[model samples]
Target: MSSSLPSEKALVPFVSVENMMRLVHHIGIETMLAELADFIEADFLRWERFDKTPRVASHSREGVIELMPTSDGEIYSFKYVNGHPKNMAQGLQTVTALGLLAEVSTGYPVLLTEMTLLTALRTAATSAMVARRLAPKGARTMAMIGNGAQAEFQALAMKAVCGIDHVRLFDIDPLATAKAARNLAGKGLTVTSCTSSQAATEGAQIITTCTADKQLATILTDNMIGAGVHINAIGGDCPGKTELHRDILKRADTFVEYPPQTRIEGEIQQMDPDYPVTEFWQVLTGQAEGRRDNSQITLFDSVGFAIEDFSALRYVRSKLDATGLYQELDIIADPDDPRDLFGMLQRAK
Candidate 1:
């Protein structure tokens, strides 16, 4: 049934990463991440309520690009994030991103924002949200295996959401680890630079792998991982890329964002097609168990799902609306006559 509603022709804003950083500074990163994590967890518990899809990836010799799109009956959102590890060599970010949010009712765009920074924030928030459910109690220390642009966000999110106060940081590039430590110095966490993945996991209850390697590198071996540790495997999100040894998956009870997507992109891809792994949403909703025992190892085989981006965009849209810190662009056509779909081009000329 169609009901009479006000025809509100409103233009939303486009926010850049710099503008987002200003907003983050005003709202505080901890608050932003905490709120974002709340949104993610809330959405996760209602997993069946969302319209989810696997991200579409475009691959190149240097790296890969991805488009993640999702909807929840009312709102539609999508993010464009590129992963070019070689971009860092040219002084550019390894992953650059932007996204759009639209109203499903009218198909009108609500907001467009740069997601390079927001992606890092959302990734960290998602990881922390999963850790809260899967990690052992009193989990204060974390081992960050890859210290890149995402390292600081992961460290801060762990501190903010999971109560992790100590981080043992490691990177093949000493400079990367140093940069992460410097960024996290006064963030109320004790940061340590470790020589190897084993050293980093020494006393850490949660180990996060955010490396950028494109190969099936085993950042966490079964020997280095201890019981009751929660592994946030983020880098092995693409096909052919992995961070944990296959043996580690056998030892730990693994959880994932989406079973079908993660089966292809996550570390579980190494295992047989019939390998058993639980969907994180199942645990969040009490349909499945998390951290079965104190001595059990838990792994979050994260592949950076579309739902995470959906939550992030929803949070960003709210903040941008509240602060009035965005610009509107005519990316969508609005014809004077509803039937004149092709008139936009003529009118522009």
Candidate 2:
């Protein structure tokens, strides 16, 4: 660590987990999620402007690590994230991440912050944003099928972005359902803890499945879903991981972020490679149709995308000036003479 404060050029703003939680509390979770949805929706409107691709991932028996990167000609952002469903058994987070935002011109990082919490927030925001467009009109209740780290965020974001006023929670573990219900209480939404996924989906217009299972698991079967409902399948994010059954994909008007990527990592992975799916940005831009009718079963196969993280970085970056919740880290070796590397090292010694 440097004894003296680093110069502005040598520093990058960092938001630690504590600071991140503080910032969320400062903005209020609902308001922050709504703002995040706005940023994500705006980015989707200019979808063609971005340099988009699938996340680069390396999988292991223990878990997977990924790098999700994107840019829109000016600023570039990427998130380094890991997913280990087994980590909870070892007292670890199922997902942890750090993100960076850089100036495209300089290639220098302007912001570097932990993104685990932000990722959950953005994922929920993206789900809610998509729900706003594809969900059945007047969607006031949602069934959250997995009561893990993402359950509370999803419930609240739906309320904030899609006008969902009630959430029914269910998880294979009753404790998980209880935990989610506890977290959701007093949030101005009616919280119900149910015994099973089928029970949770009862009378729900929106169904959000977010179980963090690395293996392919059928959190929702075809029979469990109904007409005029929107499904936000959240946890089928890896090559072999999926939450909804293949039959469900066949019947729903599936929407995805990037087809090339989603085909490999999303719920559509269960289908034939030639399976038809709509690019969600097209719906936002009026280039395609969404929710053809009140009886249409719409599915947002959310594998989580890079642009949402980019939008999240942009949103948090915009708030730093007002929140003052970041630290300047001396991460770059900035010397008086760029070419005199050895001289600078000698001076440091």
Candidate 3:
């Protein structure tokens, strides 16, 4: 390692929430989600290379904060995110995040950016990607049980990636459903606001549950689900936070991102510890079967994982040069002599 500091290494590029929104608009939301899906798929294909583990977490009465980190031998990435289901009532996002990717050898941050909106985007992308594999062939309709910050993104990503053309939405809050319907108006999707979860799933082929309440809420009952439908359960992403009834898990061919973490944070947390689950990467890579037949119910127990954030960071970095949407922050200090930190401070004074 060189004793002298490199200018690029000392300055970290930061993408604020404002810039992240701008970048998404500049790239087009659906297009970015599609590209993000490509990046995520690429990473999942080579899953063994990256160091994967459960997130380090701290839980409070109001919410939970977590650090998700991963490395692929050369580069490393981590994201700081929070989940507060009640924040929306106070005019705040229920979830927010920031992420960074660094060179493993240098151990210096290279890129830093907001992940709140990005998390919604990637969560949707991950859901849509999984649905493409597990959904019934030529599935075109989706029943979205939760209509909140993540609802619109989930609808759009399904349309863009999974070729779903219609979305039926249901939410306990009518305003939320209206907001989601309005946002998705001109996006080339057929959107309908339903009165109940059962109504939303009336004719749907893919069912997506992303409710925000951090409890074991049964958004979908076993009798409500029929054979041959693909279910994307993303909201039940924390301890004691699950959306579907346990009977549904027993009937479906369940799949997950990381079993160790999902066992603690995902819907499967309700099941026995030794419950059988197929890792999604295997389905993506053709190593394991997804839906056996048209009538085989499939479930994706999605609890957001570090590898997804790592892939999102890499995707954002790849776009920076072309978009120039980041500002450099002087977060690290530089000295004429790396060994004389005190002398450098003395000279500055």
User: Candidate 1 lDDT, tens digit per residue, 173-195?
Assistant: 99999999999998899999999
Error of 3 at 184 (Å): 0.6
Question: Could you tell me the TM-score of candidate 1?
Answer: 0.94
Q: Per-residue lDDT for 49-113 in model 3, tens only?
A: 99998999999999999999999999999999999999988989899999999999989899999
Largest lDDT belongs to which candidate? 2
Provide the TM-score for each candidate, comma-separated.
Answer: 0.94, 0.98, 0.97
Tens-place lDDT digits, model 2, residues 101-190: 999998989999999999999999999999999999999999999899999999999999999999999999999999998888898999
> Stretches of candidate 3 above 4 Å error?
1-6
lDDT of 2: 0.93
Q: Can you rank all candidates by TM-score, best first?
A: 2, 3, 1
Go through the candidates in order and give each one's C-alpha lDDT. 0.88, 0.93, 0.92
